[model samples]
Target: MTRTDGRLQVALVALCAAVFLDSMDLSLMGVALPAIGRDLSLPESTLQWLMSGYAVAYGGFLLLGGRIADLFGRRRVFLLSLAGATGYTAGLIASGLLTEISWRLVFFLPVPIALLVLAAAPLVLPRGVRPPGAREGFDAVGAVAVTGGVLLLVFALTEKSWPAGVVAVLLLGAFVVIERRRSAPLVPLEVFRSGTVGAANLAALAWACATIGWQFVAVLYLQQVLDYTPLTTGLGIVPMGLAIVITANLAGRLISRYGLGRVAAAGMLIQGAGILLFLRAGATGDYLTVLLPALVVHGIGNGLSFPSLNIAAVAGLPDERQGLASGLVTSAVQIGAGIGVAVLASMMTLGGSTLAGYRIAFLMAGGFSLIGALAAAFGLRPRRPAPVPAPTV
Candidate 1:
């Protein structure tokens, strides 16, 4: 391969690996939460906060992070995040193996990794030729408003606080006003004018809500209802992860052939079907009969839909705005996951029986997936841009 090809390949691998590690870090807590709670002697409420707090922090600053990436450089921000995530993962693994570790270790483990990434980033990533005027200052007020607004919203959902939600709405409204007045907004409002970007973000939000909510239910069913060990529970979900990895690559090619909107809609429909299948699960149902098939189907849908939505979101964006586009997509995923966990988990407890609650939660999640499918089909319908004419001499 040529030098340019080699650099591109490296960049692709690094970025993909970063995303993979980030996802794993986020998800590792699901199956392990009970174990962590027991070891730390924590209440269920505290455990809940630990899980939701990560999503809040991640989602809240994502737009700001993107703006920072655009201002400083994408490579720098990515390397920093990746390194911190890696260290955090390592610390978690260590805590698992060792006995009687302090719970605070879990929260502070990423600090060392952040420092290491700070030192090593220049050597690991390629130095690109900076775009002209790339170092423009960011909109600090707009950034603060949006970040605070998203955090409050996420916190309200997680904690079920109506007053916080109202405050969040006000803050977000202020963000819009500030962005309009700013010389250079953190996120250029014009990007939302593109149907593709808007639809992709909406679809991503719905997909995350459904899938994360389903997974939360599945974990509870496996451990609490079925009485499986945590290790066994983790092992049982391996096939779903493998299916996602395999199908995601295949979906990229399918997008090249069928277009983004069609593939995304199909994926969502398939995922909804998977969740609908879970309605058959009962207190006495076996994993093989009730859960495995749903897991496989859901995995396939995730693999197909997520990549297509991502491609669609960034399809028409200029190079300089790519970081912002990516951040928006990532933010949607985090926020949706937070909302899903809060809403669906509550549904699971409000019904007559555990089995009944599970069924209701599954139905709601499935409905969200179907809604996403409809949105993808109609809202993201592709409109190829007209070509600019050749310039006259």
Candidate 2:
């Protein structure tokens, strides 16, 4: 193979590793939350913030990050972002082991790995084809307003603070007004003119809401309701991740044959079914009969739908707006995750028994997935048939 090809491979691996780390961190935290709460004497409401806070921050700033990537260099921005992601495929098992000793170690797992990735990034990641000009018209007001609004919105939902919710609404409204006036907005409103981008983003948002909320509730159910240890909980969750890894490898081929809309909608429907199965779970639920089957089904559907949502969001966009499209979809996911977790956490406080609350949360999550399925099915524009060539032979 050529040296250039080898370098590209290395870059792909690095990017994949960073993504893995980010994903694993979320899962790892879910498993570790119970342990952390017990040790720190925190409640479920406070524990939910550990996940939602990250989601809000990540979602809120992504538009700015995307714009910065356009203004600065994508590679540079990528490296900077890599500094934050921590954990990988083994994180679930590792988190279990570490939490047995101390929960702090689980939080620290990504530090050295992140440093190593950063050290190698400069060598492997390609530089931009063109340097950016001196005049950079970044919409600072829009960025701040949006980010602050999202933060406050999450806080309001989580804490049930009406004042914060009002402020959040005001800030978000101001952000829209600012974006309309700005020369270079963080997110160009015109991008939504394409039905595909809007629908895909909406689908992604709902998918995240269902998937993230289900995970949060499931983790709690395993530990608090079922009285499972951290190690057992992680091991049980491993099958779902494995299923996702396997199915995601095949999703591209499936999408090629069935088209994004069908595959995406089918995946969401399947995922919704899987989540609904969790409603059968109770204090005496059997892992093999109940949890394992549900998890595998959910993972398969998640793998199929997740990649399709990302691709659909950027499918018809111009090359220049590709970064913006990516950022917008990702922001939708993060925001949806925050909202889902917050809403589910509130649901968990309702009903007479803890088990009842969990069932309610699972039901709500399933509903979210159904909504995502409908969006994917009906909102996305179908691809037109290619022209047939004349028989010239």
lDDT of 1 by residue, 289-319 (tens): 7778988898899889988888888775888
Candidate 1, superposed: residue stretches over 4 Å from native: 1-7, 40-46, 83-124, 132-135, 384-393
- Give the C-alpha miss distance for residue 112 in model 2, angstroms: 2.7
TM-score of each: 0.86, 0.91
lDDT of each: 0.77, 0.86
* Clashing residue pairs in candidate 2 (N, C-alpha, C atoms within 3 angstroms): none
- In lDDT terms, which candidate is top? 2
Candidate 2 wrong stretches, greater than 4 Å: 83-101, 130-134, 383-393
124-168 in candidate 2: lDDT tens per residue? 998975435216567777878988898888789888999999999
